[model samples]
Target: MSLEFELCLRRPFTLLAHEALLNIYYSASCLKKKAGEFLRPFGLTDVQFNLMMLLKYQSEQDEGLSQARLSSMMLVNRANITSLIDRMEKADLAIRTPAPADRRSNIVKLTGRGKELLAQIEPLYTKEVKRIMAALKLNEQKTVIEMLERIRGNVSEINENTTQDVSLVRA
Candidate 1:
């Protein structure tokens, strides 16, 4: 369906670019909400599930990941990560301990319960993801991957130019 029709807008989009941007944003928002709903029955939020997966896959050692490291990897703020860890800790899904190499910083690791939960959820999650993407053929999916990468590159360029322009104005 067209973006205007989906949005119930009386008027057309001002430009094709505007319509495309809105489509992407709307699609992303809907996907996030759907992901949240899918995980809700398992007593996990999308962010929490993402953190657990990162812990399971990204940790190179048994000691787990530093809060700083997880924040960077997740592209979220440290404070938000802290709160998420705190909630996970309360649920016994994860643990925070002083990093062996740096006592001042905390490392986040999945608890045994977390690992078990992830083990149970992963297969179902993968199946659901496949079902969701089944609307697109394999070739179409590949084309989408390429287009999204290009969009990301363009967005990065815009961000860099915006930062430079702001600094110049400040100076």
Candidate 2:
């Protein structure tokens, strides 16, 4: 369905650029909602699933990841990551231990239960993702990926420009 129709807009968008941005936002929100519903039965949130996947696929063998590292990788604040880890700990899905090199920083690792749950969920998750993306052909999907990358680059550039403008104003 067209974004305008889906949004029930009485009139056309004022700007094509704004329309495109809203389309992206709406699509992302819808996807997140669906994913949350899909994951809820498994007793996991989307963020937790993402964190578990990272730990499963990216962590060094038996070494785990530091909380700071997880925060940066997850694009979240340290406090948020800490809270997430705390919840996961309570659920026995993950554990935090003192980092070997830096006792002050905790290393987060998936527990055995966590690994087992992920192993069970990953295949179903992959299938759901495939079903979602199957609407777009492989080439179309590739193009979408490229376009989104460009959008991200543009956003970064704009952010830098805005920061510089703010600093100049202050100066």
Candidate 3:
């Protein structure tokens, strides 16, 4: 087994694997930077944009989303979402209203100003998304998305295992 492992290392497989990991990390960082640049004019970070979009979509159902639900949906802690909402509220982009049934919790809703800003930003956002998609052929784009989804699924599985381990340890 040791001799076989040594022979495998002599092949290009190890180098290719390292290069792939590096490429994935660099590509993700570059894309994030580009997205941040595109959103700079709107004074919105990626999380803020996600939150705003969430609220906008929720509004269509004639329902508001609670902060706890938003935090869970965003995969962030409640305190982080609370702070983000506070800043957005100060910017007049959103409002936090007490939930009718849950007085202790608040629902986040987009304000009129937020709706106007979203409208103004929609074109630029759409253009950026189009530009990203244009970089790849249809098949390549689909493959890329599928590959990313697989990676995400694997990571989630690992997280679940880790969580279970921690719970077992505590018990």
Candidate 4:
């Protein structure tokens, strides 16, 4: 049977619920695309911007981070992280060096240029974030974040269960 038929047969409610979830995903994707366009002139993708922020945050603690750890923290594949790091390196925004403690892994360090870019972008990013959040009251924004976190937790649990079931079937 087709996937839709299977979904409907297994749990019609789930199928209906997924429509709303899909709509949220699509809408978020569109918004991200627009935000990416805005950031393009700054020579940053959303992910790259996020990485720069992460690095800046860590710098405050006097801690350096590894690319592999960053990939895991960001929930992205290593190959993608490598490519992103490569691009950033070429732009002179960051550098990759062999970790002093681990020969196998490379640490990603933000350069002076990266810090400068982050400083330049912070105000604009903050303004955009505030403008986006302005649609909701302060309390509403908190509630929305809580609700999304709950949804994410639920989805993660379901994924884990599904993976276990598939493994059982294979066994």
Candidate 5:
């Protein structure tokens, strides 16, 4: 059954745009739910895993990311980052060290354990994404990506006057 069929709407949508919007929203909700379930076995939430991924890349430079920078990168506020960093530090997945030059600031770094977790889960995550995209042909995937970018641009343009870029939207 198609997404529309699965949705069991009271009546057919009058506009293609309306149906398409609902389809995208439903698809994203379904994908996020499945992904969350998949991550459960690994003891990492999606956000924590994303944070680890950021640290993994940054660690290559031998420089830790400051807490403020990480907050921006994660698109999380300071309060949430404090709790997230606390949990990750407790799990030994990451470490926060005081920046030498700035006593009040801390830098976040992935520990050996964090790298190991990413190594273990990366392949499965890759396979899962490939599996999901396999529902569409290569060209269809590319077309969808282009269409989504345009839709995103249209949406972002409306909020240009806001101080924050809409692109930094949290998951």
Candidate 6:
């Protein structure tokens, strides 16, 4: 069924671009909710699962990623990392240790339990991802990626300009 029909819209979108944006947002929300339901049985949220997987692969270096680096890599606020890490640590999925080079900074490490859980979840996750991706042909996937990148680039540029204007107003 069309998103317009599903949403029960009385009027048609005036512009294709408007409809596309709304469709992308609506689909992403639904996908996230479904994924959350899938993850809940393992006692982990989607974000926690993602972080564990990242650490499992990225832990080539001793002690894995520093809190600052993890925050930057995950595009999350540094202030939130402490609480997230704390929960993971409590669950015995991860640990934070003092950085070898930087005394003030703490590095994150995945625990054995985290690795085991990730290994269990990865197959199901990969299958789900592939199932969703199979909806589009390979060429269509590439085109979608390109279009999304262009949208992000244009929006980022406009956001940066708006920030500059706000700074100028403040100054």
Highest TM-score, which number? 2
Candidate topping lDDT: 2
Question: In order, what is each prediction's RMSD in angstroms?
Answer: 1.3, 0.9, 6.7, 6.2, 5.3, 1.5
Error of 4 at 141 (Å): 0.7
TM-score for candidate 2, please give it: 0.97
Each model's lDDT comes to 0.94, 0.95, 0.84, 0.85, 0.88, 0.89
The count of backbone overlaps in candidate 4 is 0
Question: What ranking of all candidate models by lDDT puts the best one first?
Answer: 2, 1, 6, 5, 4, 3
Off by over 4 Å in 4: 1-16, 59-62
lDDT of 5 by residue, 136-170 (tens): 99999999999999999988876784535455564
lDDT of 5: 0.88
- List TM-score per model, in order: 0.94, 0.97, 0.81, 0.85, 0.84, 0.93
Residue ranges of candidate 1 with Cα displaced over 4 Å: none
Tell how far residue 96 is off in model 4, in angstroms.
0.8
lDDT of 4 by residue, 84-139 (tens): 99999999999999988889999888888988998999999999989877989999
Clash pairs for candidate 5:
none
How well is each residue in 1-171 modelled by candidate 3, as lDDT tens digits?
Answer: 332263455655456656566567867787889889888888998778888888888555637689999999899998899999999999999999999997999988888898899889888898888898897899999999899899789889999999999999999
The candidate, 5 or 6, that scores higher on lDDT is: 6
lDDT tens per residue, model 1, 67-163:
9999999999989999999999999999999988889999899999999999999999999999999989999999999999999999999999999
- State the weakest 10-residue window (summed lDDT) of model 2: 56-65
- Evaluated at residue 47, the lDDT of candidate 6 is 84
Please report the TM-score between candidate 5 and the true structure: 0.84
Q: Give the Cα error of residue 5 in candidate 2, in Å.
A: 0.9
- Candidate order (TM-score): 2, 1, 6, 4, 5, 3
Per-residue lDDT tens digits of candidate 2, residues 71-142? 999999989999999999999999999988989999999999999999999999999999999999999999
Candidate 2: residue 78 lDDT (0-100) = 89
Span of 10 residues, lowest total lDDT, candidate 5? 162-171
lDDT of 6 by residue, 129-165 (tens): 8998999999999999999999999999999999999
Q: What number of backbone clashes does candidate 1 have, counting pairs of residues 3 or more apart or in separate chains?
A: 0
